[model samples]
Target: MSMTNRLKVDRRDGKLVMAHFYVAFISLAIGGLAGLLQVLVRSGMFVLPAGIGYYQLLTLHGVVLALVLTTYFIMGFQIAAVSRTSGTLTSKQRKIGWTGFVIMTIGTILAAVMILLNEATVLYTFYAPLQAHSIFYIGLTLVIVGSWLGSAVILLKYRQWRKENHKQTSPLITFMAVVNSIMWIVATIGVAATVLLQLLPWSLGLVETINVGVSRTLFWYFGHPLVYFWLLPAYMAWYVIIPKIIGAKIFSDSLARFSFILFLLFSIPVGFHHQLMEPGIDASWKFIQVVLTFLVIIPSLMTAFSLFATFESYGRSKGAKGLFGWFKKLPWKDARFVVPFIGMVAFIPGGAGGIINASNQMNQVVHNTIWVTGHFHLTVATAVLLTFFGISYWLIPHLTGRTLTKAMNNLAITQGILWAVGMTFMSGAMHAAGLLGAPRRSSFSEYGGASIAAEWIPYQVAQAVGGSILFLSIILMLYIIINLAFFAPKGEQDFPIGEIAETAEKTPKILENWKIWIGITVLLILFAYTIPFIDMFHHAPPGSKGYKLW
Candidate 1:
């Protein structure tokens, strides 16, 4: 589906996505600094100056990077993907896009101010019984709602394309954007419900106490799928864009769509795996959700196989021989490929760690441990972040009428390598220390000189070292992004979208049947949750009053 006509995101559509990217990049800087500070403080090598709290920085780091940055970038990327594949959005669609961006930006600001003021240091999850200010909850509500508006833009574009094309398979990228949007809309309902019906009123003093179990259950309902929300965009690039970048066709359009639909089904109904140890949820339900969680591994493995096949086919075309010779035929020099390729490798270990987290017995060992921190650092921070960065290598320049010159591409590749090395040290240390029983979500201490606490100190120092390297990599990334966005030479940068392989079977029309897929997704969610939710509410204790922990 690579456009041959001066391939680029249309300038007007470019502006819309760029608006979101500006905020996302700004968030990278703020959140990156906060992360660095956190690691340093945790290492006992530095203390926050007077009045600056460790947990406060931790909260800002989590919320800004995880929520603000990811949300903004995913929206921008999805919009760009759709516009590049389907024709440019109608002017009204762009207007709606901008409105959503403005609303989300305002909400981000509101939430940031509350966090900075230390009124909402309840951590990123904003877990109940540890309440934040009413304004904070309101800001959160706005963010979720605004994201819905953003999701609407994708649906509208896909709908318009279907209306115009009449039963044709939608552009693959556009179809992907729609899948992500629909998945997001369905998943966010849980968080939206918690914020509006529970947290908002409770914070406003309309309610005297909160149901911790129900609130947590709702959050995890949204939480695990939230991981998928962050992931699927990178998968979009991997399945669609990477083949084009490597000068080959996609392995199978049908397989790609099937994997996506599988993700949609399996990503939900599995949130309970995150709450495996939490009380008030029946053991049977947790076991059910855990089974559901393992089902996600199917689609994940499908994606892995697809990439392997794509790579091998590309290699054979280039005259490579032998089983592993295909690996040597890859584009090691292109920043757009190299950077995201690193992310793919990171996901190997990251995915393995996730499997452990999903298992009830294994989750107990690592639950609330810094190992969980290490896990997400690999998955989200390294894998997802690097892939997004890779997308920017071309996407930013493409949007800005600029070319990613050789120098900038080199810098981008360097940035990715630095991130990998840093993550290895930081995340590896975290996992090791967690196995030694170091707790997560806490500041550095020697536990009143207890001998066991001493075991964690070396790992803490290692984390600080890793964090410092990551900050340097962040600087490189920002520099590359700035150059691409503003100062690179003017040229057309092709937005790559792989064509379906000639031998591949036609994509089944049923894959695009939104009603059947979404209906099944809803059913799976209900099947997984109804019994557990009923149990949570029926046996609920008198809710506890909010605490301002910070």
Candidate 2:
């Protein structure tokens, strides 16, 4: 094959793969720096000035990673998987794929521009009554447009292959891509509705006002599932890649399928759980959202059990004796193993925090406090970040034909552990401080109470330190990825062992059995949601003067 032909090998092994790894590092660096700035300013650090810098950085840290990195990286992986699993992509589809990348990149730049200017400093939720510049909304829309286009290409190519080869089932990874894309399509609906009907009008001054409560409700519709949108990729890593990395076949493919199903069904209905503290919403609705929060636990536990069992199988196969002995037998040296291992550690504490926040009663204590921030940092910064880093390590070598040094991989593992541990201590301290009534979103001292002031000092300082360590760790990660991507020696490398041999049998008839699952999820969400809204109608909103918007 000519070099150009090889470049278009329709396989996951080429420049496109390397590009994905490099992109992950860049996004992580941007996001991590944003994260550090958030902590430093929130810590009341003397060096950090008060005002726009703090909020701008916080919003950038979030919007950049959550909006740009998550979608872009997921699409890259999805594209690669579709091509490999389908055996090839048509020439037109590859062009669409790159086009999506360009659009997303431009959208991300627009967002960052707005954020740095402090014009889009609404902290990503962009909750109602807090509007950013018009460009922010436009930037966000462009991002959605790009992602949707990518999804179309992936599904279309998959369809083309299935039509050509009538004797095939979509492989597990390909199925995951289709399912997640549908999830995104469903997830984006609320944001799309709100932006078009509410935010866009408000931004353009076409409307003097909009309903705060209603707008908030709409945002959460996308807001919470957005986490799953951020998360499903990490979970995907856990389900498909981790077991293979650890030297075991998937414990149960059916169980893995079910976890994705749970993600689809339960992820959306629970958005109101984020609103537990807000008034004007009925307690009954909050209660239901809380229940769905627990519903999320079922799938999470299934994942934990399945992943652990896979490791157990691998351990036994490698001649290790006894239960839990697999930890020692595992290939700690492999980049794939490192990513999922840290992910597992972060998942335990992060998942627990999620459950706590999901509870209506507990949420009242932690809501709008530093504790809430801590909980998410544990999950997003810790768990999701690890998955991103791990995949880079695994893919970069094959994509770039460069051997990522073992020393650097080990450095990554150590850094990951410190990052997790640091986040835990800081977040735990925040939770304790929150119960002590340290209010969130304040930029002042304890308003003349020394005792309260004294209590906050320690936790704030700890967060700063934790944030600092995490920040440095992110820099190290960037160095590692950059070295591998551009500077490392280039030579052919094989894909990780134990990848499911691509074959006709793995593909499924329906890449996205859209009607059945999507329909069920919509209905379940409606059933779970309507009662809350109905009850709220009879009750009154707190602090609302007949639905004031201005």
Candidate 3:
């Protein structure tokens, strides 16, 4: 069956997908505005309104963009991918998805209202000792639960398909979607435990104190994998969609599946790398996690190799000559291709920064600094955000039955470039300032005219400029998306699925052995975390009472 036919049959599912995107874009707009405010305030160029504190805005920005926008957008994209690849969802699955969306939406509203009211100034991490209203924690918990429910719908559908087609392999996109959903379901367990068992009770006065170390451990357990949760969707685009856009085939489907499996296995067990700078965790345990962190990089390297091979093969087939001719031969004109391609390139530095952060010694140098901020910006901001932007160029139109006009396409290209340029200035400055001992999560001017502080001023100014540009770019993106959703001419859109170059190289059935993979994943997590957590609880210090700093 054709992708068009699949999409036509699932047109009803489009409403659910559209709801998710709408929430995502709305979060992006507000979060982006808050980002601009952060830079301005941090640079000493602008003061916020009287009732709106800087911390409040920071919390709002982080939660909305990192938690809300990414979660909603990823869920929406995966739903569309599954429906388009596998088949239309059953009514039950649709209901489950809508239930999750509604719950998540309510959670977002509760969290946003608390942030706006200056009641929940705890940053996205919501780390212990810095408490917020119980509603804030409850709201975040709902968001996680809602996403799990949505993922359950995808998982159920995938299982149903497998049962019906006993011998057939799932479509690459559908398989990837299901794998990601499972990973999410597994990853959120740590956070859910922390929120439901620890923070929620403490916040609600049911408990007077909470174990800070355990709370942080639980959060990082979920935190590092959360990055991969954001990343895999982008990887899906790179491995599956970009190849089609570039008139190439996936270099190796089996290798791609292996990469996802590797990610699923390795992504969770390495979260201790984030806590290397903190005490209570054993150094030996941290070292082990650092090694595991390097291990996880294998899948990404495999992906990079696969992408390059695809590009080279396609370029050579198109009559390109010379060592790097293939690089030049890529479809640079298509906004859909260029945006994600640039995003992948940005990951080179982003991934490198990640390695630095994962290292115990190196992390001591950059931890809690603006360097960490720069690292994630390169990752989630450029790599993930840009790829999503690329997807949105076609996705919105595909769901809405609208034509993505040439002007809008051109504008998207412009938006991508602007984002790149702006990030270059902002993240570059952040990296430089962090190296010079600049702190992160600070609202005040650091230097106060001291010579050491004076050194960071230029970088601060550059960040402000970069942030302003980014704000404008997002506005342009929202304009394009709104037009695509509402005012564009109606038409059928193409859903491109890449072919595999090697027809003879079938993906191994073992690659799809969920039981084996999940078992291994559980064992690895137990190996990595069991000792540290046991030690934490056994010799745990008296819990700390919550503090409301603001």
Query: Candidate 3's C-alpha lDDT?
Result: 0.89
For residues 1-550, write the lDDT of model 2, one tens digit per residue: 3211122333433445445445655777788876776667656664445555655776777777767677777777767656655556666776676677678777778878888888888887887677899888888887888778888877887677657656655556666777788788888888888777778878999877666666777778888888887787777778777776766787766666778888888888888888887777777777877887788889889988988877777788788887677779988777667765777787788898888888877777788877777777777766887887787775666566677676877877876777776776677767777777676655434333556677677777777787788777777777777777778777654443234423213434342466888889889778866765555444535554225455
Report per-prediction Cα RMSD to one decimal.
Answer: 2.1, 3.9, 2.0
**After aligning candidate 2 to the native by TM-score, how far in Å is the CA of 193 from where it should be?**
1.4
Best-to-worst order by lDDT is 1, 3, 2
Flag regions of model 3 displaced more than 4 Å: 1-9, 446-451, 542-550
Decide which is better by TM-score, 2 or 3.
Answer: 3
lDDT of 3 by residue, 1-550 (tens): 5322274536778999999999999999999999999999878888898778888898999999999999999999999888888788889999999999999998889888889888899987988888889999889988998999899888988887888778777889889998899889999999999999998998888877777888998898899999999999999999999999889989999999999999999999988898888888899999998999999889999999998988999999999999998888888889999989889989999999998989888889998999999898999999999999999999889999987888998999999999999999999999999998888877645455676777788889999999999998999999999999999999987777787886539888998889999999999999999999888777665443322322
408-517 per-residue lDDT for model 1 (tens digits): 98888889999999999999999999999999988785352668878999999999999999999999989988898988898888888888999999899999998999
Model 1 steric clash total: 0
Go through the candidates in order and give each one's C-alpha lDDT. Answer: 0.90, 0.71, 0.89
Which runs of model 2 end up more than 4 angstroms from their true locations? 1-24, 49-52, 165-167, 444-451, 497-512, 529-546
**Model 1, position 252: C-alpha lDDT score:** 93
- Model 2 gets an lDDT of 0.71
**TM-score of model 3 vs. true structure:** 0.97
- Give the TM-score of each candidate: 0.97, 0.89, 0.97
Candidate with better lDDT, 1 vs 2: 1
